[model samples]
Target: MVAGRNVLRALRDIRSFRVVVLHPADAESDELVAQIRRIGCRVELIWPPRDGIPDSTDIAFLLFRQDALTDAILRSLEDRPLAVTLIAIVEAESPTVIEAVVRSGASAVITKPIRAFGLLTSMVLAHKFSTGKLISAEKMSRLQTRLSGARVLEQAKAIVMSQRGVTEPEAYALIRERAMANRSSIEAICASIVSTGDVPGR
Candidate 1:
């Protein structure tokens, strides 16, 4: 299924995930609490969490009333990769606060007097965005690795051409032959040449 479209489904489509509420206190609005329970999400409300959200948590609703607490929460979240969807609940907004929320990797935000349905929607959206972001980051990392390898290979090919007076194609062919003989990647063979000033199987 295409991401971000699952929310269009009926309420029955909502998956039961572990939901965590990080607040200054345990006393959450009864309406919001009741609504979350109705959707069958296992909810835990923790006030002044010392150790950040638990590993079992899949979604987090973070309530912020002061900048200091917000900074502290963000630091805790950054200490490790939790893969939890963050939803910020704020009573007031400021430029600094909004910037902090973005930097902290909040996927969605809800204001005070939280509506039952609005919270549900935010939860779903946060999960979708979080999943998509992770996938994109992974793809970017792979692309970066490939690009770095290519740059190294080019440099190694240049080294071969300069030393052996070979054409570009010949240099590449030489690298490929060594890689095949060694049962390794051309990049690995090239890296060996660049690093050790010698080709594999030479």
Candidate 2:
């Protein structure tokens, strides 16, 4: 229950979150409520039988409370795309227990006695992972740029080695030196050499 302070601290700093604290909604949830005071979220202290729950909840916390563990409700969460990440805190989790919980659509399992910011840290990590979905053009752009550079280098190396009868390593070093001397990126230099078999403007 003292860990409630840690939970609130995490929640307060967060933008918004949906947390289901199963019975006994002890001091832990109480503290979290205070932290969530202005966060525009709902701290549902409920047993199962919840229908039409928001599917976009950022994270779900399971406190080893039975009321939160009915078969029908678990199915509802798992059967939909909303089943992103579930965190379970138990006193001790056996291999069987761990596997079952994981297979039940919970992504992470933490051992309890919830001490020294363990619970809070795990939850934060879970939130990050769930929200850190890829598809950003920045990441794709970097990837594509690297891929193009690699292809250009390969083509340049082939041109240098075939034309000058040198090893690939030597050809690469030569291209790099020329690029550096000209203050151009290796990709730009390689692209020119590949397309024309000679450095542009040289």
Candidate 3:
């Protein structure tokens, strides 16, 4: 009972999302729009994929055709990394269709005839997957920056030690003191030291 209530709560939160549908105005698209509206999300229907997703869209239901994969569709997929939860509307399960879906970077896929079943599940899962991907990307970027800063700091310390005949700890202390005096970061001070072969305020 508790888990059921939690699921209902999540479904209620789905109403807050803004959805965009890029499928043509056919029966399939109509059914999709109707179901999405039933789920309580604001829906915008756009025929023929656009070059970019709208700025307000939180989720996008894009039609993926194996033969009709144009540059505009590909651009839409490439440009909105981690911004929109893409749910591919595929017509078939052929190898070609599967490959296109993979290349499109869709977080989840909804196979046609656009039935009500599994649509909600796909939307929920896709949103979760997109959120997780964004978080992971941010964490990886921060880690890379820290690693690069560490390497530069080490080089700066070596330069200081070679020039002043001091130990590594003393070199780092000098860098810290200069950083504090200038109201800058240690990494900024170290970067300066590495570039100029002379510490600031010395």
**Per-residue lDDT for 12-91 in model 1, tens only?**
44556887888755345555666777888888777777888998888888876656776888888996453778888877
Q: Which prediction has the highest TM-score against the true structure?
A: 3
- The lDDT, on a scale of 0 to 1, for candidate 2 is 0.63
Assess candidate 2 and give its TM-score to the true structure. Answer: 0.45
Best by lDDT: 3
lDDT of 2 by residue, 115-139 (tens): 4345556667676455443334457
Candidate 1: residue 153 lDDT (0-100): 91
lDDT of 3 by residue, 44-129 (tens): 89876545678788999987776654446766568675768889888878887788778877899887888999888888888878
**Candidates sorted by lDDT, descending order?**
3, 1, 2
User: Which pairs of residues collide in model 3?
Assistant: none
In candidate 2, list every pair of residues with a backbone clash: none
The parts of candidate 2 lying over 4 Å away from their true place are 1-13, 27-42, 64-70, 132-202
Worst 10 residues of 1 by lDDT: 3-12
- Please report, in order, the local distance difference test score of every candidate based on alpha carbons: 0.79, 0.63, 0.85
- My TM-score estimates for the predictions, one after another, are 0.85, 0.45, 0.91
Model 1 regions more than 4 Å off? 1-14, 29-31
